[model samples]
Target: MAYGEALALQRDLAQRRIDRSLDHDLLLLVEHPPVVTLGRGSHAEHLVAPKEFLAAKGVELFEVERGGDVTCHGPGQLVGYPIYDLTQHRRDLHWFLRALEECLIAALRDFGVAGERRDGYTGVWTGGRKIASIGIHVKQWVTWHGFALNVMTDLSLFDLIVPCGIPDVAMTSIQKELGERSPRDLWGRALDAVVLAFCEVFRQQAQMVELEAVRSGA
Candidate 1:
């Protein structure tokens, strides 16, 4: 889905959750076209590339309300937007963020990747290079705008911005680490791993709800 479309869906779901109309938490996994997003604390100078250059490369830019610095999203990146009610579990935001990092770390471990969390940072990293970026927002104790894991992403695109406002840090991907591996296959497996990890970490029963069922209020 497009980033805008996903954002709109998140808003709708968050509102439904706030109204107590949605009973189950949702994890939305999607791949977006090349785009750059600036979070609430993002500095404009972090965007190293010019607007014309970004436009020429078909990269869209949006200043978002999520908490973080500027970050890029594109094909081969697995973006997970978890619309969850913290009231059902723990209401502590710091614990929730750490849980998310742990969830990603566990998922990476399934693929033989050692993902770790850096001190004073909010992402999963390996060998000093970040593998995932996390930025979230909570409304009425419900969270949205979760994590972005670099699967087969083109790492060069990250050069356009000081990712998460961190300088001298590198962005790495699964494909980069596992050369000659099939990105399509790895992406599928990663999704499964993440879903399972999320369920286990949050203590929720996993259900595969069809989009049609969700739209129809079934």
Candidate 2:
């Protein structure tokens, strides 16, 4: 999906949920083309590449409302946008962030990766390298712009910016961790693990629905 369209979809879903027109929580998943996003907490200096450099590399950049520093998304990454209502769950952002980490960690365990959290960090890491980055924006307690898990993403993309605004922070992917043992459908497998873990952690029976269904208020 394009970053701009995804952002619009999230806003639409979030507004529907906030207005009580949407009856269920949603976790919309996608893999975006190469694009850099700046969150509300992003610093100008965090982006290393200039406009010409990124344009030449075919990477699009945008500013978003998510709560984090700058981050990039591309093919081979799993981006999950959970349009969840916090009122039905815990209303605390701290708890919500931790719960997101817990789900990612549990999902990583399925792939034999021991994911952990660093103090004062809001993501799941493994072997001192970040495997996933999480940033969200909640309006009226309805969340949008969720986590991005590196499944088989090119690590070189992180070079274009200071990932999560941390200097020299290493980003690792599932393909890098599993190497030759990784399945050909590595992205699909990772998505399955994440959905299972999300169901367990959020205590919701989530099933994948068509984009049209979601768009038409189904």
Candidate 3:
């Protein structure tokens, strides 16, 4: 699904939690429209596009409730939504975020891409350009929303906005950086890498389950 649709689904999943139906432990992977999303309390100046221009460009804007400044998501990006119960892991948000970064780092390592975290920043990076972005919201000790990794996303789309409010920082993709060594089967390899990373970093055995998409209101 698209990132916008996935965001809507996150809301739906949260509502399901409110209604006490859906499992608190869930992870979803999706991409988003070419949109710039700013987190809570982020400055409007961070976005380089005017409201009208963004609409004209077919890009949507969202002032999300996550815990970061601004970031972009579009096609060929891998966005992960991990809906997990923090209570199951001692309610350590820091630990959870670290684990998330570590998971991505491990996944990238499998592809010969060395992913690392900045001293104070959250997302994974290689050299100077950021390859992944993370912004999440937690409610009732349960977490939702998550990270977006640039697999083969159009790096130019990032030029239209200030990514995570960081200026002059480059953006990259696995395919772009790895060059000849990058996996030809990106989606398949990424799926396996991320799932493996999840199990390794979280120190838990996760059962991969598949479910058919339900029609709206069903």
> Which candidate wins on lDDT?
2
**TM-score of model 2 (CA atoms):** 0.98
Query: What are the per-residue Cα lDDT tens digits for candidate 3 across 1-218?
Result: 65567777787776676456765467787777788888984778778778898889898887788999888888889889887777777688888898899999999998888899998888999987799988889888778889998998899888777888887888999989988777679977887888889988777777766535422422
Sorting all predicted structures by lDDT, with the top scorer first, yields 2, 1, 3
Compared with the true structure, what per-residue lDDT tens digits does model 1 show for residues 73-152? Answer: 99999999999999998999999999999899998888888999889999999878899999999988999999999988
Candidate number with the higher TM-score (1 or 3)? 1
The per-model lDDT (C-alpha) reads 0.90, 0.94, 0.82
RMSD after CA superposition, every candidate = 1.4, 0.7, 2.2
Score every model by TM-score: 0.96, 0.98, 0.91
lDDT of 3 at 141: 75
- In model 1, which runs have C-alpha deviations exceeding 4 angstroms? 181-184
lDDT tens per residue, model 2, 1-218: 99999999999999999999998899998999999999999999999999799999899999999999999999999999999999999899999999999999999999898999999989989999999999999988999999999999999999999999999899999999999989888888999999999999998897789999998999
Model 3 C-alpha lDDT versus the unseen true structure: 0.82
Alpha-carbon shift of residue 90 in model 2 (angstroms): 0.8
Considering TM-score, where higher is better, how would the candidates rank from best to worst? 2, 1, 3
